[model samples]
Target chain A: MALAEPPLGRTTAPTRPAPQKVWVERIPPIWWVLGLFLLTLPAYANDFILFQVFGWTFILGMIALSLMFLAGYGGMVSLIQMSVAAMAGYMVAIFGTSGIAAISMDLPWWLYIPIAILIAAIFGTIVGALAVRTEGIYTIMITLAIAAAFFYFTRQNYTIFNGYTGFNLVVPPQLFGIDWRQPVPFYYLTLGWAAISYGVVIYVSRAPFGLALQGIRDNPRRMAALGFNVTAHRVAAYTFASVIAALAGILLVWQNAQIAPGTAGIPAVIDILVIAVIGGIGRPIGPFVGALIYVLLRTFSPDVLLTFGLSGERFKLLIGLGFLALVFFSPDGVLGLWDRWRARQARRGDPLTGEKGE
Target chain B: MKAFVTRHPTWSLIIGFVVAVLLWLIFAPWTEGMEDVLGRKRVFLNAIFGGVTLGALYFLVASGFTLIFGLMRNVNLAHGSLYLLGGYIGFEVSERTGSWLLAFPVVFVVVALLGLVLQNQVFRRMEGEELRQTMVTIGLSVVLADIMLWIWGGQSYTIFAPDWLSGPMTLPIVSGYRSSGEAVMLKYPAVRMAILFAAIVVGVAMWLILNRSRLGMLIRAGVDDREMLAASGVRIQYVFLAVFGFGAGLAGMAGIVGGTFQSLSPGEDTRFLLASLVVVIVGGMGSIPGAAIGALVIGLAEQLGLVYAPTYSVVFTFLIMAAVLAFRPQGLLGRA
Candidate 1:
């Protein structure tokens, strides 16, 4: 898609309006089928599949989507998204009711949710301000350090964070006389939020703000020369990404029924990056696809390892090797591999790839 | 130094005052008033030594990190994994050979060879692609960590110092007054002091080599301008290989030092990686002296914070990093 092209050159020059198209015709049939499949999967899927697999995928996808928004579009590979998400999760447990009555304020859902997002957003903005001070690769290093600090602080501070053993039994509130924690309900809940976030990202990608961000990513100097506030745009991108991450975090806590330091630990932070990269950081849909792969591997790798006469704990090794291979062979991840294959198929009528002339 | 003083006279004065106070606290025997205001002189002395020694270890790890980044522009995130790997290998070597000193050369060779392979094979393929190289390192660290865990298991391992270095050595500093009017000398672990001395030697030798030697000139030139260096007919690949291998080797050796003082575990890789990252950030990227000063600051902050404010020690370290980042994004010693 040549995302690096500046979107400001061909701006609204007060010319005649472009032709309008029907919204229904814009979407391909494949998307409609995929959407329908996802929406109706709970009807036949088991409770385990509904609650654990798909629910976890959507939550992780949303978080990774936030990462893609920054890295793919804004050219900032931030490792702090997981930390921000964890902050939101922790805020929910702290502000809303939780297992620890002494620390948690026991506020209502409506009050605490917004407060959680707000606090997490501010935290992300501060991190963003600090990070945007540096350029390119420094962003990853700075964000990783800050993320580690957040983890360590959360683990050490017993007053507010409750220390090592964090909040537990933090289920979603029953808003409409329905248990949101149930497999079916949770599946639908995560699906709705994930769909909304995905839509938001897709919508924003073509918007002026997103275009400016892409332009800045390509050449900050040029963007600044064009009278854009480079730092402000970058920091604002973090704020926007943080909101998405925070929302995912809230859902993540509800899914787990707990929140702990491990949720946003170094490994977990890296895992988000892995998901985004492996899925393909070039597009918003990549994170969701990557999340699904990660969730499936995480859920099923243990059994697969045992079957191979290896310890189930070797799933990390498997994931590591796979990631290494992917980075080596296809830097843009699975999506890149798919893209090349499609391009090759388009070049020739290949029976092996099952492609005909377009 | 004169230029720095002239450039920021106020900063120089504040720094001079701080240094003066620190010297007084370290050298002068605390009176009752001083002892009351601060805790005991012995505790303060111990923290100072501890922090300095810890800083030495950090310098060992971070110097390599900075050097690698400086020469190759490769952010070797797996540098910590190299450290942990070296620790594990050092443990095995010492355990089998029954000689702690033998582990250094062996681990250095093995890990440095691994570094050579990574540079020549992996990173060289994706030259100039900074983000891809970083991703590969992250993946490498993960794979190496898991492999180490698979082989070493989840248990922690601590390499024992040789017999001569194991026991406590007394220093000339006055710890306190005895009831019979005798001065109580301060005693600390002999191994830590020896390690500290070794680190100083290494740091000095590296500085001398980099600043004074032809090889260092090549490296410095490469850092300043790789394309120019290459155009000058220098085999820049060899420079990259040597720096990467040497840095990896240094990190491996630091693993032995860390394993000697602190136990090596699965998560130590990440901890030390973060330490190196923070150190480089605070010290300034690709600057050896910066790494040293940053390490000292962070190490001191950590130990002192641990001693006085146990809960908020991490906070203090984080605050220093934040302040440095806020003020000088290039780092304390980094070139813009």
Candidate 2:
């Protein structure tokens, strides 16, 4: 059951060339307006909205971006990506100069952050090593088992993870004496990290490893026949994705000023998957778009519904309906539809006029 | 039977059984000088019984999961949601009609019909698109869980059983001797025994249905090769529908049984979903006997770990799963 390749000798330039570059050049006008709006709104928005909702959304978007790299590019769908981040978050809290035992032991941020990322990366490697042998749903289940096991261990092991209450880790020291927790400071910090992560993801997506991974995604057998060590590449992809998630995890702990099992457990893990899918899979900007939608729904839907006398819990129902609708209508996600529309318009244009007009 | 026994050597079987028993003995809490402690031995035995009952419930749900995956090659991630929805439906029906028996079958039928409709409408439309189907099912699961939360509050609810089944039975086993020179006593719950019976019946029925019936033959053929079976003039869609409904109905039945064993909460959907996924992976997807073995391993590991290493019980299962996958990904009794 391999799919047949499209026949060669099809017209390559007539319907495609100009608009492909045009769409690439034409940045959506809405983004500029939206950016300006966001730049101005922080001054007027409440501290809670700016710090908690926006900050957490950015952090979550960062984590979802890591999963997107694997699932969208490598065809490796995993459920334990959140667990890797959670592990990093927990390590930060455990090793940081906070929690119950912190009076006896403390580590500087420089030393602690690297150690946490290393620990999370090693954990991800081990999981990937075990999971790479399976295909499709088996891979998903194995990751889920790993995640569930971690959740249970963290929930019950109080001496180590501080038990169910979790650890109240100290926030990162403000740069140049700026109060990071202040709404504007935190939002900017989150946005800066998000931008860096997004840029790295885009760069990686176009790199040789990304192309090879996409090759494996399209046809693993062919890639293997072409001398690519498929398993090794998969493990490498997972490790890189894990590092990305770990960065987000560190940021998450910093934003919340704490790390709990609940942050990385099944519900939160599944929510990340929801966010990725809602935004669009395999697209560079999907995670950011999805995060915006999710954060807005999570933040405002409760108050919006409460005004109509409905309970806040009904917000989940709305979110659930929205998710279903998105999946039904746009399986490739919003970005996919946008790309398709541009392609359609390019196919409809007069190809000969392009060079003549130029 | 004699020929079969002779051809299949019993050495591996005997060794496996002995090892399992030794592991149980080593991990059993009652052996840790706990007989003298008041109610410690009782609690230990109760936990074992609880574990076994829970294993049966897992088998019930995973049986359906494996069957669906085997027949259609679609991993119904929403199976847990269907189970949760079934529990809520059963809860509502039982509350309205004041009859638990009516609620049981009614919930099963409703969920079965729901599965049929979903298969026809959503899954069928996305046939051959495995990833899309998976995502859509996940979306549906989230929607169902949210809707269920809206209808039934997130607080846990207990399913009431009759007085006869609810009470405990005193089984006078040599539950070990106390340091104070008294015989330890253990009272197992009657509900657990009832669950054991249900497991046995379901297991046997599953065997007979898959091996002895015409419909079972068609299902087996479908799993082996759907296109060939269709080429043979059999309508594969009807078989897929039947298998899908049967699988979902099994999940509903499990919900009814599990609701009595554990508190049914909105969160249990995700917990059970994860558990089902683990079972399928460890047992090898689509194998009934494999599901049974996987459930037993997970259930026993969890129970024993809770007794000896409570802090690491959850991690223990994952470690076992990892080891199993590393060494024997096909799982016990599963085809490679």
Candidate-wise lDDT, in order: 0.94, 0.82
Error of 2 at A223 (Å): 2.1
TM-score of candidate 2 on Cα atoms, chains taken together: 0.88
The residue ranges of model 1 lying beyond 4 angstroms of the native Cα positions read A1-20, A350-358
Q: Which pairs clash in the backbone of model 1? A: none
TM-score of chain A of each: 0.93, 0.85
lDDT of 2 at B100: 71
Best by DockQ, which number?
1
Task: Please state the error at residue B47 of candidate 2 in Å.
Answer: 3.7
- Compute each candidate's TM-score over C-alphas: 0.96, 0.88
| lDDT, residue A16, candidate 1 | 75
lDDT of 1 by residue, A1-358 (tens): 5698767756844467667769998899999999999988977899999999999999999999999999999999999999999999999999999999999998999999999999999999999999999877899999999999999999999999989999998989998999999999999999999999999999888999999999999999999999999999999999999999999999999999999999999999999999999999999999998999999999999999999898999998888899999999999989999999998878788678666767
Tell me how far the alpha carbon of residue B293 in candidate 2 is from the true structure, in angstroms, after superposition: 0.9
